[model samples]
Target: MRRTLTAALSIAMVVALSGCTLVSTLAAGDTPTDTPTPEITGSGDSTTDPSPPDDGGSDVDGSGDDGAGDGPPAIPSDVPLALGEAGEIEGRGGNPVGTFQVDGVTTGFDDCVEPEEGLSYVQVDLTITAEDDLAAEEGSLDYATSFALFLLYVKGPNGEYLGDWLGHECVPSSEWIDDVGPGESATGSVWMSVQTPVDEGLIEWRYGHQNFVVPFP
Candidate 1:
């Protein structure tokens, strides 16, 4: 009996030792992993592409934009000019000559010249044509044309004259009409300062038909 009991105890000790060994082996085999393994397997080569870098640059040329250095070319418009009469008349000096004339007015010139010690200003009377008569010929004073006066320059005894005449530049519009009231006339003036020898006499304006020699002074 004693021998049998001892053998049974020894066997139990061996079984416990074996069980501990098995548990230790399982623990050793199990390891904590950072990345989870994918279940779906891909056959073809798998690759990860890196992100691209950022660049702050522009692709704007002169043709692409405006308002900066890229602006459109400038263009001029067709402007019309007018003078009072067509023949020579008594102007500043000894009844000069009148070259400018209105289309309809029968009178010689609707203009006057005033000489003031090397300075001169002319108050020239003009007629505006009616809308219906705007088409009248150049020589006819229809008195109702939608027109504006653009005086480029004038003729002086000394030479070509440019003045505050710029003030006479007409507003751009065919729709604007200058109406003539019956016998009453429309009037405008051109102012000028003498540049050349005021005594050159017989001052024919580059534009107007009238030539003024002025009261020889």
Candidate 2:
């Protein structure tokens, strides 16, 4: 009777040990996946991070720039080029076209043309010597289109392009000449309207959907 009891006890112990072994093996293999999860950081998620690249990007400070596909190529808000400091013009193929200079800038000159209340008239003197026919067109430049197509702007004190420079239609007070052929030079003033009581800002010029700037000192 004692020997029967000992065999039974041994069988029970063996069965218990086998159950524990099987449970441990299953627990070891119960991982959801073999791949380790990627950690997220710094304006990104679900990807492993690497060393950042070194490349400059666009510099937009969120100022009011109407990016309504104005030009085929995107125009940037670069630093202002100085007045009378522009070099010889370059052709489409980058050949020298001609020369131009901002001979003078006059502000607050309200002669016969009456500006609206709280506004003033500013004029820019342009002298252009064109080697080609196209550059000559810039001499007696006329923007008969909407106000947005105006060629020149006198930036207000707030650093915004809130000025108006119409074509040479205000007749008697303007010395703006026309029919400037190639190899000839023309000097004229392009009048613009700026906010009154403005003592600072830049002057912006547009040509062929591109923009240029000349700061006010």
Report the alpha-carbon TM-score of model 1 versus the true structure: 0.23
The runs of at least 3 residues in candidate 2 whose Cα sits more than 4 Å from the true structure, single-residue gaps closed, are: 1-72, 76-79, 113-115, 133-149, 157-159, 167-174, 177-181
**Residue-wise C-alpha lDDT for candidate 1, range 1-217, written one tens digit per residue:** 9999999999999999999998997889876567797797787644754765455344355454435643222222222233333332221222332223333211121222333344333322333322222233243221222223443233443544523232332323232224333222344333334333333222232212222222111
Off by over 4 Å in 1: 1-122, 125-131, 135-145, 157-159, 162-185, 193-217
Shift of residue 69 alpha carbon in model 1, Å: 39
| Candidate 2 residue lDDT tens string, 1-217 | 9999999999999999999998998988875568887885686554655856555454466454556544334343343477777645443333555554566677766673545666667767776665644543333232111112255567764667667655434435446533334566677776776666455667765543335666665
lDDT of each: 0.35, 0.58
Q: What is the C-alpha RMSD of each candidate to the true structure, in Å?
A: 16.1, 12.9
- Model 2 shows how many backbone clashes? 0
